[model samples]
Target: MRTTATSRPTSVHLFCGAGGDSDGFRRAGFDVVLGANHWQKAVDTHAVNFPEAEHLCVDLDHYDMRKLPKARVLVGSPICTEGSPADGIKRPKAAPTPGQLSLLDEGPIADAAWERTRATAYDILRATEVHDFDAVVCENVPRFATAWPLFHWWLQGMAILGYRHQVVSVSAAHIGGENNPHAPQWRDRIFIVFTRQSMRQPDLAVRPPAWCPTCEQDIQAVQSWRNGRTIGKYRQQYDYRCPNGATCGHRIVEPYVRPAASAIDWTDTGIRIGDRPHHGRGPLAASTLRKIRLGLEKHRVPALVAVNHSDPGDGRAVPAHASPLATRTVRIGDGIALPAPFITEHRGGGSTTRAIADPLGAITAGGNHHGLVIPYRKGGPTTTAYPLHTIATRESAGLVLGSDALPEDIALEDCYFRMLSPREHLRGQRFTDDYTVLGNGGEQTMQAGNAVPSNVAQWIASALLEVL
Candidate 1:
């Protein structure tokens, strides 16, 4: 640890699965004590990665908080299958689980995940209040707070305490990660950032100023995010650190994505194009397209680079990697004078690790996948539809993307097409090739596709930390 603010004494974690948020909080300089219930792999991973922090495997519903120490920050990720809207139209809490519904089946994994999360959240909140920690950060499926009744109660309960909840949605990339290189894997989630409002300085406001463009987009996207949405639409950059936390001593790597364009929506300015200097332009960029005389191409990108206009006496300085198109499989570029718009997310995941698992996807080499297009309609007869191989819709000219996604441009078969593999999807999500991309084939593929691009994360996190 850098012995920074995260090194404080009061930090604690409940239902901390897989330690994603824990790592961010740790990087932010807070000590972390992770707690979880049947998440064995996650607990093991947390211990392996964060040995400095204690990992308690005991169930929070029964665990004694007095025996444990306190911390400044509290983080939790509640499971959402049961309470989430994605699971289906709401189910009454009283509905009988397998244990109650049948004498034969005793275990219900979905029910267990949901109930445990609730128990853990309540326990953490109460215990943290007991300790009077400075802040509490609760993370989970974005809709969990809105869909679950008990979640609503927890929010109200937290309000009664001195802390008022400030729900802020963040991308994994902003906290420091890589961007997906190829396809867009949108993972938007809602987090409840709670702190003692009175204790927080006015400048530490989590809500960005009204002028921040990203904040405006987030506000606009909330409604699109409500009901079930699509998967793998947007992805942001994220990072993996080196032995030292300082960037001066580190090498940063990320995916080679279709970099965001610098062009702004000029419509807002109300300035006529004719009034502008760059006029009589078929999209100034298109006019400058390098035409290959004999199919031999030449030119700068469609305005990827804009020459700086300088006085006759002053020389215009070109950037270091002034490109001829970078070839690295995974490369990240800082937003030039032009700040990139956030990768826009659709109704569902919204370009973060904010995933809601869908067991209904096709059987890939990995596990099942969830997506925009779903098969197997409820109560519908066995209609004349075979298993789909391609997520494609033919447009007037050629092929355009379909509900989910089609197979690779080079895949041999059709109906046999599984959604993009994790590696390809990782590439699609804008993660660099150097990072040790992980997942056990299908599961690994899902993991990579579901993760944020590290480069993007580093940029966003750095911006956030500077404010801190």
Candidate 2:
């Protein structure tokens, strides 16, 4: 370890895509000294936002850690595709026992690739051996515990090196409240902190009181579990109980959820759905059209809705402004619904839409596919009420009205559609507008999707600071 001194606590981040971890550490009062990553684009993005810090575009698996400078904290987020469910690779049900071959059934080449990815975790251990860090933090998908066969031994190695570690499973959506900035996207991650001294794990879980629309009252929120197992996805697992109990017959109560509507730019109304070209064809895929119809069917009012086109559950539509968005992945699979009547102009003459009803789904490093569907009148503005009809084509649709009419009353021909921009994706990730994201559109999306939400990182850093 180098003997150079610093005024504030210093940290070094590995696999530091887009510098999300570094940004959080900075917010928590740490001087992020260095950020290293394997991808040149990611490193470039990090360098743009954190010009003060030294950046290295090198693979940690092969780099010598002894050449690195010493710091108070060492943070890393290893590549998680191998362990992530989105990749569709079958993960080991449990860590393999000694002398057992993990992923052998997948084939030698596949097993080798898996081993290469899994070995990234060992790089953290290698770094620990070379540096005398006050604390070491590693973030990854929760499945990392069972996916990497050497996970147990990795912890043992840390203990042998005189560090006590604690692993906590947390969601970004649950890390903020009245006193803290909220992460709009619901991302579930595991944070492992290893320190020389034992410390109490930071309580990052926050369940702010939720409003039960049905009960029309504030209620305490509790975790939802069935048969002793947690239910629901992301932060939705925490729900509110109506004071009226079973009599009220309202089971869909949700905790206070920050919506993704705050991140959208309504000025861009997007193109008409019928005009979009798909696969060189004149219109969108039939499946996509079906999703829009389904979304309109579910939400009949002039409210923003999120339609998860890629969801295994039949492209479900949820109110966008009511709950936090789902986790962002490398690919954008979620779409939005905007009613033309709701997309009115503000007093300043700037176009604005009603608040979104649900949070944006996970952003991925690949590209964004989050499309926007806007409902508008077919010929022009008309006061005459029309009967509800299924969305068929762009020429036949109209804006969805209130409960008096019904969502199906709107025609499909009146709807407009377009994919969300990269800047919007960054906003959902909780990155400030001023934070520069350098790269092509795809690169920017990748950086945003791969980033650890700065708020979550800040919370973890603050907790670590207390014990440091």
Candidate number achieving the greatest lDDT relative to the actual structure: 2
TM-score for model 2?
Answer: 0.69
lDDT of 2 by residue, 107-210 (tens): 22212222323227778889988887878988877666655666678889999988887776656655654445666555777788888855554544434354
- The sequence of per-residue lDDT tens digits that candidate 1 reaches over residues 182-268 is 123324455666667666421222221111121211111111122344211122222211222242232221111121111111112
**Candidate 1 local Cα displacement, residue 336, angstroms:** 22
TM-score of each: 0.45, 0.69
Q: What RMSD, rounded to one decimal, does every model reach?
A: 18.8, 11.9
The most accurate candidate by TM-score is: 2
Error of 1 at 81 (Å): 3.2
lDDT of 1: 0.34
lDDT of 2 at 6: 41
Model 2, runs deviating above 4 Å: 1-6, 82-119, 198-201, 204-253, 277-282, 301-355, 378-408
lDDT of 1 at 116: 36
- Superposition error at 440 for model 2 (Å): 1.2
For model 1 the local lDDT of residue 442 reads: 38
Residue-level lDDT for 3 in candidate 2: 32
